[model samples]
Target chain A: MPVVGMVGGGQLARMTAAAAVGLGATFRVLAESANESAALVTHDVAIGSHLSLPDIAAFAAECDVITFDHEHVPGAILAELESAGVLVRPGSAALGYTQNKLAMRERLSSLGVPCPRFAPVVSVADVEKFAAGSWPVVLKAVRGGYDGKGVWVCDSAVEAAEVISHGIPLLAEEFVPFRRELAALVAMSPSGQGAAYPVVQTIQVDGICREVIAPAPGLDPDLAIEAEAMALGIAAQLGVTGLLAVELFETRAGGLLANELAMRPHNSGHWTIEGAVTSQFEQHLRAVLDLPLGSCVPAGTFTVMANLLGGTDPDVFDRYIHVMAADPTVKVHFYGKEVRQGRKIGHVTIVGGPGDSVESLRDRARRAASYLRWGTEDGE
Target chain B: MPVVGMVGGGQLARMTAAAAVGLGATFRVLAESANESAALVTHDVAIGSHLSLPDIAAFAAECDVITFDHEHVPGAILAELESAGVLVRPGSAALGYTQNKLAMRERLSSLGVPCPRFAPVVSVADVEKFAAGSWPVVLKAVRGGYDGKGVWVCDSAVEAAEVISHGIPLLAEEFVPFRRELAALVAMSPSGQGAAYPVVQTIQVDGICREVIAPAPGLDPDLAIEAEAMALGIAAQLGVTGLLAVELFETRAGGLLANELAMRPHNSGHWTIEGAVTSQFEQHLRAVLDLPLGSCVPAGTFTVMANLLGGTDPDVFDRYIHVMAADPTVKVHFYGKEVRQGRKIGHVTIVGGPGDSVESLRDRARRAASYLRWGTEDGE
Candidate 1:
């Protein structure tokens, strides 16, 4: 029996626990507390802080391999675990690059990967020189950033100077107007076998993910093929064992430039749960376990996923029935979380076949969220 | 916020927990321990014996409504709970009929429902009377029987005497040479509304379900309609509040006889999880909660399901990758159980459109089980 240990106990860990049920795998979770999320389903739950190495070592001893739900594990501890021979998916060496974008951009550029032109900028002088020829520049912190945080856009150099004093490692690059956003997800086994899911377009609102449309909805065959190729190339080059989600910017010149990367599961690939024959969660587990990959075709011709955000009330979870009663075909997954404003509580996924209208799918997804979060249809 | 309390913690409870997630209902389990059988995903589990009414009440106090995974709840306690206003679904009156075969037969016969002619046989003379014209007769215990247990076939009065002496409240009935076994399931609400799922052919080996063919391949249109009508009639007449599974014995003479009734979700309806527009589990939750019923139309062109039995070795649970790697579309569900011989450990369901061969479907289901249980590709 293989006992798998996970570092975090959030929704990602909750979903992975659900997938682990099929293989009869035992999942041990190191939650921050006894009542933390995902503690309901895991076989063994150890309440401990992430920075406690003894606690992590105790949790890891009960499992054959260790993985992570978030990228907050320090590189020093990861290296210590690796030296002590605990199998870690996405080892510290490969994850270090993505943890800090400055290292990733410089490394990928040297390796001949197509990345946006950028230079390290710690002061106003550095930012002005980088944007001298370019009219607009985007400034980003190399670490501790997610969901559009730690980012600033300057139409001129003066705007960059005000944000430079934050003292985080900064990278300034020329801002290019892109046609659309695309994400390519790749899973590679420890033994070098790999599989790629179809590229999808991500829709964001107020710096939060809202939906994902497979094949970017209207992507040509050539572009789709190119996306898969680029994604697989990065996974193989980085020796990424589990999953790699690379965000791309479709330049006006018809080429894709690397925008960002997530070394673990990302919001862009959530559609794979219902759309693909093999879900990304299953694929990631198989890859890390050194097992064979499954098929990677969409379960239906078209699929759309909408995230469920937490509502204002503390009892927002009571609205789940109203949504499920209206549309039984919609698949809803809820994370057992305390509700507050703007927190991701769950998601609804609906798959439609070829020629299915996007508006109808979108309506169903939104209605499901509305019904589950706020009881908008309660009186009716 | 409906907190539903379930008496038995098993696979059925596990599935009910899955459905409760979608409906935003909470589930509390009364089992021997937190890991008795269904501690994987329940809301809160009370560790105590079900026979202890105080323990049961303590569990029920946290629930607004009470239900059961199996028909093993004591009638007296249920009556007590009913008197206390706990809202026991299917109520004690309805459940008592299904709890005892003798009572079920008598009620069905009085209601003009089609059933095999039977007679209570306390002595060999009674068996001789019933077997005078019939060469063979079926003898069954009145209660506490399932999965080929407590049933026997007698070709002579002497044989019948030996079997009937095994228990009190036994009966003898004329045996029917049935062409096949079929099941019709219906979900009825407290408001008198009911929905019927498609009739499915049940393949039994040694009285255990092996595979189920949804819509009962090659069934006549009239017969199919009649099956649905009969199921609805039975459910409405019985005032069933959740699922009612009617097991039918189809005689060679083209007639149907009632074999048994299950007042909750049955194995035959497992195919609906992935094959129908709405799964039976979700429908059951809706009906019991008095929510609107969903359409019972088949989602794909066909659906097939097979049960997976656990073997002796406990380590056999780690074969998740082999089965998934073989066919990712084959949905396998496992009940977190310690392996036991001949025990129903889990099941696999397959859904596809027309042109999928029955042999292939059967092979896929069996192969998944074989892979999970023995780590062998014998079925493949």
Candidate 2:
């Protein structure tokens, strides 16, 4: 069995571990803690921080192909590894653009990919001018942001100034009114056999994805096709291996713009586990290991995945009973995480349609997830 | 948080670890080896063997409930624990009848539950008398039977006599020319609440289950209702805690006969992991711990579960690509067991239809499991 080394140890790495088992592949995990990564499920666990060069060198030496749980590894080290003959999927040069939001915008723009008008903001003055053109401007941290963190929306100069801190370069962008948030997930094989799942609508709450609806309800077939094509084109152009999640904005103005790029598995593709024939996790293993890519097609007309956020209450087991008994169709997946406020504790994926409609499925998924967090019988 | 002590260590325990995490239940695994049971996932490995009563007592001392990863534990030891004031779910008395086929038959006869007529034959002469009443007899070893082992079908008096002498005292039954095989999966709580998944048709080949079609496709509605009722009655009467799989033979004579019983998580119920709202693992945890039982309604009218037999091929990974790419709708699960011929390695579940008709589901399910094994494009 080929050994696949992963950079970060999170749920994505955990899922990859599940996929690797099916393929009879080995996973070499580099987690900060013993229980942080899916390492417990697999063969080898390397306990260390991602920043340590010797730790990474030891991890790299034991694996056949190297991949990422998240794209946070320093580019210099990756480049050094590459020069020293280590195989890195989505090699360092392409990964650099994704690691830094500023570099991402510049590269995508140069490649003629559609994106929102944006400007770098090191100070309040930069935000003041951007917000003046549009009623609301989006302020984003240049690096390290997830789940609505380090992001702000400014209706005017005052709001944007609140987030502008000393010495940190931020970016301000036109806050385009969007019809829905969509994601086009593609697995680009080492040989470049690109496979794309149907465009899915991702519901965001406080900037963190709360739910994902596959086939993006009410989406035009042509628009979805275009989005998928764009995702494939971007992955192939970048010569990327493994999964690439192209997060998009389906603007009310009638065009899909690239919102962001994720080099590893993303929350929006969770529905694929139940709704697609081949899960993104399985396809990622196939791609990074340079094996034949599995099919990426929707199995159901509609699939809904709701994120389980650890809410205010500490003991949610009481609520899980209510959620499970409420519906027989929704599938719940809870991570082995100690519950904390607003943390992604788990998720529920529901697939229906052609037989069961989108509304019923969505309601069931929403009710199941909400019940887990808040024990609401009447809410949905 | 109550602690549940488990015997043995394997994938079933690994999945149970995932469920116990959500419920905040602690599992103290008494495994034969390190990192063998689901307790390994939670790092709750108790390094000891079920054979060692001293070590077993120490494990039992920590847990509030005693359960099992398998049904191989000595019945005498179990009775001793119950005598010593340990709370063992489905105590030795209940499990003894299940562990021994002869005892099970005698108990079922006394209880007047409908079952196949059988005689406990200790020698070839006793088998001759049994064969005279039933020309085709199914012979089974009294203990430790799994995945088509310890079973034989004798069509001739010569074969019957030879078969009986070969094994220890065994149960020989009149073979039922059944229309279809079915399973009544019921979760029996400590409080005696019984939850039943729709009776599902069991697809078999050479005495091994290949697929399970929910609602036992094409059976009369009354028959489906009766199966659930019979399962509930047995669960309640036996005071069986946790889940009980009542495998039944739907005969050509138009009645269901009890075939076998499993007190813990059984292979027949694996479909619930993806096809039902709550998995059997979750339900088992809830029931054994005396929590409220969840609804047992089918997720769809048709949820088919197919078992994957370990094959002799070295290129096993290719089979994954063929099945996953061919049918994204089919749910596949592998146990991460080292492969060998004719082994119950894993299973695939495919759910279909308009949420009605058991036969339709059975057909779909049969095709999913068979396709994986045979690598065919045509579904059952």
Give me the candidate number with maximum DockQ.
1
Q: What are the candidates' individual DockQ scores? A: 0.38, 0.21
TM-score of every candidate relative to the true structure:
0.92, 0.87
- Docking level of model 2: incorrect
**Whose TM-score is greatest here?**
1
Give the alpha carbon lDDT tens digit for every residue of A100-134 in model 1.
88998987788777888999998999998988867
lDDT of 1 at A121: 94
Put down candidate 2 lDDT per residue, A246-278, tens digits, no spaces.
999999988999999998888998888767757
In the order shown, the chain A TM-scores of the predictions are: 0.94, 0.95
lDDT of 1 at A256: 84
lDDT of 2 at A309: 82
Show the lowest summed lDDT stretch of 10 residues, model 2 chain A.
A35-44
